[model samples]
Target chain A: MRVGIVVFPGSNCDRDCARAVAEVSGRPAAWIWHKDRDLGGADLVIVPGGFSYGDYLRCGAIARFSPVMEEVVAFARRGGPVIGICNGFQILTEAGLLPGALMRNVGLKFICQDVHLSVGDTGSPLLGGYRPGQVVRMPVAHADGRFHADAETLSRIEGEGRVAFRYCDAEGRVGGPSNPNGSLAAIAGIVSPGGNVLGMMPHPERAAEAILGGTDGRALFVAALSRAA
Target chain B: MKARVYVTLRQGVLDPQGRAVLHALSSLGFDQVRDARIGKYVELEIADGPRDEAEKAVREMARRLLANPVIEDFRVEIPGEGEAR
Candidate 1:
């Protein structure tokens, strides 16, 4: 399976994401520059994490207008597997590919640490590796990661089973300080209505290597490739 | 022409920065300060044009880029142009 990693000007995690995809699926991923208009026939497209556009104006706000995003949007519209990590998630929301916006953390601090996440949805390819209610650990690094949406939208997303992950304690209980960024309902990840697009604040690639501490994140890439094949 | 835009979080949306500022003020003996809300102030310079058209363009910009309608509200002002508040 071919994986495409989109790179924006300030994206710092493209190489890492590519390595994770290659390691998990044994296929070297291709790099798609922000200026490029095509996805290079990728079966899966990944928007890697980084401070795109230097986080100017707003996180991912400027990167949403990148030429490559036009093709990414089209690919997602065609029900292609698309995953956005961290700032990439912000970009997807900013581009209207996903619902809601990621606002600044409730503490106004740049949070960087490993967090426990409870899988909430198992129907999507991105999260199919884990069973619902399972807890996994992934590192998150961002200042603006609190997800915000209207009450109606939040209710609809939850009711539709679009929520893919929620912050939780080691015991798998969600809420309170278990929420690292104070995201609404402790949401850490979500999938689109079509289940082809996913945006999450945590850096799954960072946790995909055993050398990096844990390999739970590798299963996500494996599941994506498995579904694509 | 030039335009100034003010982007503020919508009512009921939590503003962590604003809360921090309020706490700082309270610590500085400014107990009278009941609240604080921090927002963005952007200034733009564009080609001089019809007042109506200019307002329309800037409004579009605010909606599309300057502010995220999900949690923030934006106001555009054209200085000395009969107040397009």
Candidate 2:
């Protein structure tokens, strides 16, 4: 399966995403420039992490207006599989491909550390490999990783079981000091209502290899790539 | 026309930066300061146009780019236009 990784100006994780995809799927990921309007016939699209457009005017705010994002939005509308990691998650939220917004860390500081995420809904194709309540370790690096939604939206997301992951302890217990960013309800990731789009703050790609200290994130890539096969 | 936009977190949304400022003020012994909220102020220059039209356009700009409706509220003001909207 061909994977397309969007490259925005200042995007530092594009190559990391590519390497992870290549390692997991045995296919070299294509680079889709932000200025380009096509996905280059990719079966899956990834919006990788990084400081896009120097993170000006809010993270992912300007990147969502990129020419390529127009196509990404359309592709997602057609039920294409899309995974947005970190800044990519921010971009997806800004593009309205996903719900809610990511706000500043409650502590008002940039954080970079390993965080345990409890898998919530694995019904989504991208996360089907994970079992509900399973805890996976991944690195989260961002200042605006706090997930926030209006009460109504939060209830709807919960009611629909759209939550994909929540920050948790190694034992899978949720909340408290384990919630690094002070995200509402400890949300670490969420999937679109249709279950085709998955957006998460943790660097799954960064944790996909054993050499990187863990392979918990490989399941997501394997599941996503297997679907295309 | 010159337009100024104010973008702030929605009333219910938490503002960490604002809280930090509040804490800093308290640490500095500013006991009278009760609350602090941080927001962005953007200034724009628009082509001369009808007063109502300019206001409408600026409001649109605020909605589309200057602020995110999911977590922010924005106000537009044209100087000498009486009040902000």
Candidate 3:
């Protein structure tokens, strides 16, 4: 399967995402410029991490209006698989491809560290390879990763099983300290109502290789590749 | 026309930055300050137009880009004659 990675002006993780995808799926990922207005027929699209447009105005706010995003939004609406990681997640929410908004971390600090994530929902293709309630370790780096939404919208997504991941301890317990960014309900990831678009603050690409200290993130890409077949 | 947009976190949403600022104030012996919340002030210079039409355009800009309705509320202020503070 061919993967497309969006490269915004300030994007720094596009290469890492491409390398991870190529290693895991054995397919060279294509780079889609933020101003290109084309996805190049990629099977899966990834909006990787980094401070796009220097995170101006708001995280992902400016990038959401980029020329490529119009096509990305259209591609997602057509049921194409799209995965947004870290800053990409913020952009997805800003673009209305996903619910909720990512606000500044409650502590007013930029957090960069490894975090434990529980597979809250396995129904979505993004988490297809994982069993429900499975725990994985991934790295998170951001200053505005606090997810917020109305209570009604939260409950609706919960009832629909759209939550793909949740912050938790290694033992799979959820609570303070483990919820690093103060995200509502400790939501670490979520899928669009269509189940085709997924957004998460953790950098899965940073953990996709065993040599990088973990291979847990490889399963997510593997699942997406399988679905593309 | 010139418009000013004030964006503040919605009521009931936690404002850590605001809290930090409040704590700092208290530490500096400004105990009389009951509470404080931080917000953003954005100024926009737009094409000259009728008062009502300019206000309408500014409101749309706030809703679309200046403020995120999920966690914040925004008010557009276009200074005019005979308007009370």
**How does model 1 score by TM-score?**
0.97
Tell me each candidate's RMSD, in Å, in order. Answer: 1.6, 1.8, 1.7
CAPRI category for model 3:
medium
Per-model tally of clashing residue pairs: 0, 0, 0
Which candidate model has the greater DockQ, 1 or 3? 1
Model 3: per-residue lDDT, tens digit, B1-85?
5789999989978888888999999999999987889899999887877989999989998898888887889999998766642
Residue A113 lDDT in candidate 1: 95
lDDT of the structure predicted as candidate 1: 0.91
Which runs of model 2 end up more than 4 angstroms from their true locations?
Answer: B81-85
Model 3 regions more than 4 Å off: B81-85
Judging by lDDT against the true structure, name the best candidate: 2
Q: Summarize candidate 1's per-residue lDDT along B1-85 as a digit string, tens digits.
A: 7889999999978888999999999999999999999999999998988878888999999999999888889999888745553
lDDT of 2 at B80: 64
Error of 2 at A226 (Å): 1.2
Off by over 4 Å in 1: B81-85
Clashing residue pairs in candidate 1, if any? none
Question: Each prediction's TM-score against the native?
Answer: 0.97, 0.97, 0.96
Selected candidate, larger lDDT, 1 vs 3? 1
